[model samples]
Target: MASRGFIELLRLADMARARKNGRQGGQESDWQGIVFEIGGQRLVAPMGEVSEVLTMPEYTSMPLVQPWMLGIANIRGRLLPLTDLSQFLHVPSRLSQMSQRKVIVIDHDSVFSGILVDQVLGIEHFNRSQYRSEAIDSKSPFAPYNHGKFFKDEQDWFVFMPSLLAQDSRYIDAAI
Candidate 1:
C-alpha cells in the first residue's frame, strides 16, 4: 500500500509539471506588437518598426507642400517632418486639433518622419497563428501598406508596415 501511494504521488507531480510547461509554451509562441488608432481605424505595427511615441508638437508650415504634410517639428533638436497619416493614405480623418493626438516616430534606413495618429490603444500580444495575410477589404486605403491582419478581442487589427511606407515614392516626395 505504501509503494502504491508513492507511485500515485509521483504521477500527480508529473501531471502538474506538464501543465505548467504547457502554459509557458503557449506564451512563448505569441507575437508582440503596438496597437494604435489612425483615421478611426484600429491598427497594429511590429514593435521593432516604432522608434518612439510622442505628443503632437508645434510645427512650422512649409509652402507648396502636400496637404497631408502637416509641417516640420523640432523634436529633441532633430528636425522631423510631421505628416497626417490618414490624409497621406487618402483616408478620411476624424482627428481634430482639439482632440488629443500622438505622433509615432519611425526611423528606417536613412529616413525619419513622424506620423500623426488619433491615439494609441496600447501594446498587445497576439498569437502568431492568428495573423492572416489578406486584405481587410477591397476599399481599404491602407491595403498596399498592410502587412497582414490579426483578430483579437472580437476586433480586427490591421498590421501597418511603416518601413514600406517610408520607402514609398509618394511618401518621400513631399513637395507639391
Candidate 2:
C-alpha cells in the first residue's frame, strides 16, 4: 500500500510539472500578448512573432514609395524595409519630437518588415481574455490596423496588430 501511494504521488507531481510547462509555453487561452510603447502610447502585439527592437538608422529610400514607408535599413547586413508606425498608425509623429526612435522588426512567414516606433517600453504578457474588441473609429484611416482597445492602469490604449499591416499589398509592393 505504501509503494502504491508513493507512485500516485509521483504521478501527481509529473502532472503538475506538465501543467506548469504548458502555462510557460503559452499554450493557454489566458496568455496576454506582448506590449510595447510607441509615441507615448502602449501597443500590444502577439508575443510569438516579435523578432527584435532596434534604434533608428539610415535606410535607403524608395522612389515613389507610399507616404507611410520610411525606407529600408540594413540590419546585421540584411536590408529591411522600415515603415513609420506613426504615419502607418495615423498618429502624430511630432507629439514629443522624438530624437532616438526605434524599429520593431517583424517576420511573418519569412517576409520581413521593420516597423518604426517612437520608443520601446518593454515586453509584457497578459491574458487574451482581458482584451476587448472595441469598435473601430470610422473616421480614422488606421482603423483596420487596430486590433482593439486595451487598458494598462487607468489609461486606455489602442492595440495595433502588425500582421494586418503586413498583409496589405501596399506594404508588400513598395520598392526601395
Candidate 3:
C-alpha cells in the first residue's frame, strides 16, 4: 500500500510539473497578446508591455529628423518621441473617413516611445501555438515586418516581434 501511494504521489508531482512548465514556457499561458489599430493596419502587441495609447496630439518638430519621426509630444508633462509606424512600415500616411487616429506608447529596455497611428481598434487574445513560421511573399510590402503568421477566420494574421521593432535602426538615434 505504501509503494502504491508513493507511485500515485509521483504521478501527481509529474502532472504539476508539466503544468508549471507550460505556464513558464509562454504557451497556453495566462497572459496573451493584444491587437490594435494603426492607420489602416491592425497590429498585435503583447498587451501590458505597451505603456499607453492616446489620441494623436500636437508635437514639437525636431529639425533634420527622420521622416517617420513625428516629433515629440508632451504626455502628462513628460516629453516622448513619437514615431509614425505606418511610414516606418513603408505604408502610405493618407487618412480615410473610417480611420481612427491614436498614438501607441511602447517601451523597450526601459526606453519609452510612442507611435502615431490612424486608429485604435481593440485587443485580441490567442495561444502562442496559434502562430506558425511562414515566409512573406515578395509582393507584400509588409514582408519585411512580418515575424510569423497566425489566423483569424479566413484571414492570415502576421505577428511582428516587439523586440525587433524596438531595435530597428530607424528608431534608435545613430548619432547618439
lDDT winner: 1
lDDT of each: 0.77, 0.65, 0.62
Error of 1 at 154 (Å): 2.7
| TM-score (C-alpha) between model 1 and the true structure | 0.79
- Residue pairs with clashing backbones, model 3: 39-118, 100-118, 100-119, 101-118
Which scores greater on TM-score, model 1 or model 3?
Answer: 1
Task: Tell me how many residue pairs clash in candidate 2.
Answer: 2
Q: Residues 47-149, candidate 3: write the lDDT tens digits.
A: 5556666667788888787777778888778788888777777776557431246676777785678877676455444555666678456576556656676
Residue 57 Cα positional deviation in candidate 1, in Å, after optimal superposition: 0.8
Predicted candidate 1 versus true structure: per-residue lDDT over 8-59, tens digit per residue = 3433454566568674422343676667887778888777787777778888
Model 2 misplacement above 4 A = 1-29, 32-34, 37-40, 95-99
Order of candidates by TM-score, top first? 1, 3, 2
Candidate 3 at 142: error in angstroms? 3.8
Give per-residue CA lDDT, model 2, range 79-114, as digits (tens).
898888787666776445434776777888857988
What is the model-wide C-alpha lDDT for candidate 1? 0.77
Query: With candidate 1 superimposed using the best TM-score fit, by how many Å does residue 7's alpha carbon deviate from the native?
Result: 51
